[model samples]
Target: MPYDPPPELAGLSLAQIAEQVAARNLPPLDTWDPPETEHSGMRITADGRWFHRDSPITRPAMVRAFASLLRREDDGRYFLVTPHHKQAIDVEDAAFIAVDCKADGDALAFRLNTDELVLAGPHNPLRAQGDADTPAIYLSVRHGCEARLDRSTWLQLADIALADGGDLSVGSQGATFALRPA
Candidate 1:
């Protein structure tokens, strides 16, 4: 089956987006602590492209499946883990990219390149770093993994912050996040 990306964020209500988020059933990567470790030779580029042994993994399903198994250790290394095996994968920047985002009520939702929905809140906090001249924003995905917001998505988020109060900040789930690092 072909992968169908979710509809535009602007068209969906917060409740609907939340429902979709709740419906997702990702692998329990945390519980699976495989004793054996190996190298997967897979790398996720800074631009969110997945490659294996210098070949692009073009299949969305395969990419999504691999993404679901991803786990980042405290030392900042990424691995695809199972109950019996753990394999390393290199990440140039973030593990995923926030391809799109939307602001609904007091919450913000982001859709990743892997078709994963992330609702920015206490658990999934947004962080902005770098200087005013070149700022980078990221959202926590899961298991110590983060997603870098794409250019367009960052612009959308900027617009939202401006419209809210022009303070270069946005509030979600009772937390206020500065769009740029202070």
Candidate 2:
């Protein structure tokens, strides 16, 4: 969806704009379903890199702008949706990577590759796929999309993951999510 920024942001600094964008009120993606369109030039790599026509999108600002436009539909495909258009994009893994995370008191908040923030708790739980020795970590982003946690970030999260009996759990905000679902 096209964001018509509040007129007040016109004079803000880049950092300020980024902060606003990070916390901006987003349209309810669940409510949007425009007709599907095609755009084969855009691709999100396995490591969360964006490319256009086989060239890496090196500009961080442009990448962030594109990230804001992404939407994953129910069919397990990703798209860039606007009020008027919904165009397909290739996602090798996921659209974003959970690069790092920090704690707000006991609440864990993750920082995705897009710089979007998500807290891990009951609403946005952490998940582990495959065997514990080598697993894929994922954090729910929004809607039905998710961000895969890179090994370093997943290890960081593991450090804080609480041990409950034989299961690994992430305890925050009075809830605990077992990494290996019980």
Over 4 Å off, model 1: none
Q: Compared with the true structure, what per-residue lDDT tens digits does model 2 show for residues 69-88?
A: 78877889888887778888
After superposing candidate 2 on the true structure, give the runs of residues whose Cα lies further than 4 Å from its correct spot: 1-22, 162-167
TM-score of each: 0.96, 0.79
Whole-model lDDT per candidate: 0.92, 0.73
Clashes of each: 0, 0
TM-score of 1: 0.96
Candidate 1 lDDT by residue in tens digits, 84-127: 89999999999999999888889999999998889998999999
Q: What's the lDDT for residue 80 in model 1?
A: 92
